[model samples]
Target: MTSYYDQRGVGLIEVMVAILLLSIAVLGFSALQMRAINATDESLVRTKSLTLVRNLSEIMRAYPNAYVTGSATSFTTASPTATGAVSTVQAVMSSSATSTVTVDAKTIDITTSANGCLSTGTKQETVDSIVKTVPAQHCNMSQLAARDTLMAKKIAKDEDISMTVVTCPGTTTQAIQTQMCVIAAWNDTKAILSDSDANACATSNGVYKTDSHCLISEAY
Candidate 1:
């Protein structure tokens, strides 16, 4: 048997060990919480981007014959050159000149008054489809397309998301058809299939890039 006096420091040692373990647990929890928050943020952005891309597809479909099937329009990441950087790009079409928007000395792609895309405003996406003419006159295809572009752009800007709208090489096995692609880009540095490269968005031909941080939707 040992006296309490002889064991005086034993309790202190145990207490210190407990404290060390507790501190480690706290640090781990903190890290996990931060990771969860980041994941949530990434998910939110991606969802919004997908919605916007779909919206664009519907807009194009609504205005039949407005879009020239051969041409392409991209409202893509602000920094297409930088891989995995958190930025938006909006590629405008000209069919002749490239229209771009610059900020902080960085250039982003935006669509111009191209044959397929009408450059204009955001959201109010459904407004154009309302046929708000006073006498219900025939709607101009070009006007509708332009309004659709603007509405899409505004919505994208509001969500802080990037966009890319392009015409893809549709399959022609049976009959001639056209395919339109809409891409929503976001920061997806830490994700699956991303282990390969950071160019998973749309290419010039509207094909998906492997491991890139973007989503694509199609219209025909």
Candidate 2:
């Protein structure tokens, strides 16, 4: 017959081996959980960025006239600084996003001022300009340069994204203008490809590049 003490000691080495294997398994599972958490965080950031972009588009639509005529004024300033233009608003919108995610129409210079109206009539030499006096833009001009800046912040330090304002292929003056698309993507990092680039055509890393990946169209 085997002694109880002898059997107990014999199982000790096996128990030690089992404990070591369990520890290793737990460590491996923890690593995978960390990776999953990181991925979820990244997804949340991207979603927030896209939602911000959409909010901007809605704001632009609210002021259709100012955007089209290039008569938009700076957001904070009361006076109209320049002839109605897209470049002015675009620059401000992009720069502002780095600091504040939510931007009002005034921030982009989309607001109009009384000074923009013309002075008429020799007797009084002044006229209260009608709301219709200054023709507004036909279609609202939505700016998305801010998206590129936000994208850069999420990616690698060396990575930079490009934002190209692509106008619909036609005269923008029409009542129902074709939806203009805003193309933004990481230019330096192959991890993210531009919409038109051939690299976007490939399926890799179990993630395929769709319209939501690179290009953001402002058209509703």
Candidate 3:
């Protein structure tokens, strides 16, 4: 016959084991949740990078800069600065007194001074009929390239990522054309600049680093 004292603390041992198992399960769930969150954040950054890289590419094309016409790969590290978020206003940016233009993806009423430039004076109205003060970047020839880089810089800053518009060093002189590489790096300790000897995000030779959290998109 077993004594009651012999079974004393046996139930306590079982309870302790159960508590440990529960703790382990809770820890595992928390880890999984954290992993999911990190993955989601990475995905979001990548998506933004894609849009922004393409956006910069279009801006470069619209501006027709030296990189597009040089026919030889060159390095450009001009990180322009600007004030607010850039609207996705993909317009021809013409200057006219009374005309309609797109603002933040919405067509709006545009009016400017007789000189026909936003730098002089401009007005913008949204489609909702609510008149808000926003200038149209039209006919700013001297600042077109500046504005392009500024837009790229501001958007990248807002997205909490580092980026640049550098030449995608063409390897072959015949088949490979002089291309611009839009590089974006996230969770990186420093800006993703061209490093000829280091394994970087889109190396100086246009090779992308596999172990780094970076992306490279070509725009020619």
Q: Name the top lDDT candidate.
A: 3
* TM-score of each predicted structure versus truth: 0.57, 0.43, 0.60
Q: Write the per-residue lDDT of candidate 1 for residues 1-220, one digit (tens) a residue.
A: 4696798889899999999999999999999999999889878888787778777777666654442221233322222233322112112322222333322322233443432233343232235678332422222444344445655776776676666555444434212124655667766422112224455464454456655667767665
Best by TM-score: 3
Q: State the lDDT of candidate 3 residue by residue for 17-135, as single tens digits.
A: 99999999999999999999999998898899888878877776665422211111111221122222111121121122114332222233333333223354556756478877656
For candidate 2, write residues 63-111 as lDDT tens digits: 3333322232223211223343343234333343443222234232112
Give the TM-score comparing model 3 with the true structure, all chains together. Answer: 0.60
- Candidate 1's clash total is 30
lDDT head-to-head 1 vs 2, winner:
1
Q: Which of 1 and 3 is the better model by lDDT?
A: 3
Worst 10-residue stretch by lDDT in candidate 1? 85-94
Per-candidate clashes, comma-separated: 30, 11, 0
Candidate lDDT values, in order: 0.50, 0.39, 0.52
Give the higher-lDDT candidate: 2 or 3.
Answer: 3
| Model 2 score (lDDT) | 0.39
Candidate 3 lDDT score at position 198: 47
TM-score ranking, best first: 3, 1, 2
